[model samples]
Target: MLRGTAAVSVQRLAPEDLGPAAADCVFEALAARPKPVIGVATGSSPSPLYQALAASPRDFGSATWFALDEYVGLPQGHPESYAEVLRREIIEPLGLDPRTVHLPNPHTGDHQAACARYEQQIAEAGGIDLQILGIGRNGHLAFNEPGGALDSCTRLETLTEDTRSANQRFFDSPEDVPTHCLTQGLGTILAARHLLLIAQGAGKAEALRAALKGPVSRDCPASVLQLHSRVTVLADAEAASLL
Candidate 1:
């Protein structure tokens, strides 16, 4: 989809085919840099892609990874914490060194300072070469909820009821889900050289449409992708139905 100077490439494929397709994008990013710094998202949508990467013969040992967000108040080793989730799903499977993986510090006493330090780390790593993302049903990118500033930087954000409800399946109950998170802001995400967003299932149809076709606005946080120079959106048949 072309909107003036910004272009978003949209591809629709079967649910099973998304992994390989997304892997191709990852490999391309890896090939472009000697030591690619990838921004990885934690969620069900990106699970297949991680599986594909893990199964491949590619050597991801040299690549550095930064997580997009982490649930505040979750214990360090909590099973559902984004950090541990990434360790189990990506680091372990891909045989990546734990030293090369980075995630926002939700346990910090001063969250504002933690957010700044994270941004500095990314900058020192030469910025992210490729950023993998998954849209929330509410159109949020990462934990950047609606009403957030488009130029917002990495910071703490309170999760909305809708976001909490959507994530309840991962917890024992809705109340167990964290009320806050530390997320890479829209500005930080936009700084990435390339973006690959994957979506699946009918539940994501409307948000995917709004992200790829709706007007660029804070109301639909993902709609901000329309302003980026390079963005690739891969969705399954059901998710692309509204598009």
Candidate 2:
């Protein structure tokens, strides 16, 4: 049911199997090309994989990482900031040099310029070797909420109520959640040579199905994977039920 114009490798597995498998994939990529540049997503969904990756730090020495998105207007040290999350999960544990990891400045006054500069930095890093993703309840990617254009870029976005609610757990109260964010567009995400998306839990089943089988549309942003040359989707049984 997951139709694609390009050959996408679909690896369906139990959620319990994903963390180790993801580590193996990282190892393989690193073995093939040392100093590989990696694109990372933050959220509870990717925690397991990050834990596994952190367990093997030396294997990650050659890796450079880029975060998928950040909440606009939030300070860098904010507890809910993606930068803080990445530091705890991917940076410190993996012993990755801070200089090698690039993240957009969410608090920049000139957000548009920040985005353009970020894009240029990505290109200068030889492009992303692998991009990691997690699906929103509404099938969004990064912060690209439903209805995001297929060829989007790094820019500001108004967070949907659904997305804000889904992310509220990170804040003390729903009211504390930011209403805006800066996310990499579908086009930016698709530019990676390889894509790996991880989904788990029963709640993700519908979105996973939509991503793999539904029509590629701005309404279901993640569906844009249909156009990517290499995409590997790893999901738990509950998440893959529809597939």
Q: Which candidate comes out best when scored by lDDT?
A: 1
Give the clashing pairs for model 2: none
Candidate 1 residue 13 Cα shift, in angstroms, is 0.4
Report clash pairs, candidate 1: none
Displacement of the residue 58 alpha carbon in candidate 1, Å = 1.0
Indicate the residue-level lDDT of 167 in model 2.
90
List, residue by residue over 114-227, the lDDT tens digit for candidate 2: 888889889998888889889999999999998778999998899999999999888999888999988888999999988888888889899988887889888899899888
Every candidate's lDDT: 0.92, 0.84
Superposed by TM-score, candidate 2 places the C-alpha of residue 220 at a distance from the truth, in angstroms, of 0.2
TM-score of each predicted structure versus truth: 0.97, 0.95
Give all candidate RMSDs, comma-separated: 1.6, 1.8
Off by over 4 Å in 2: 1-6
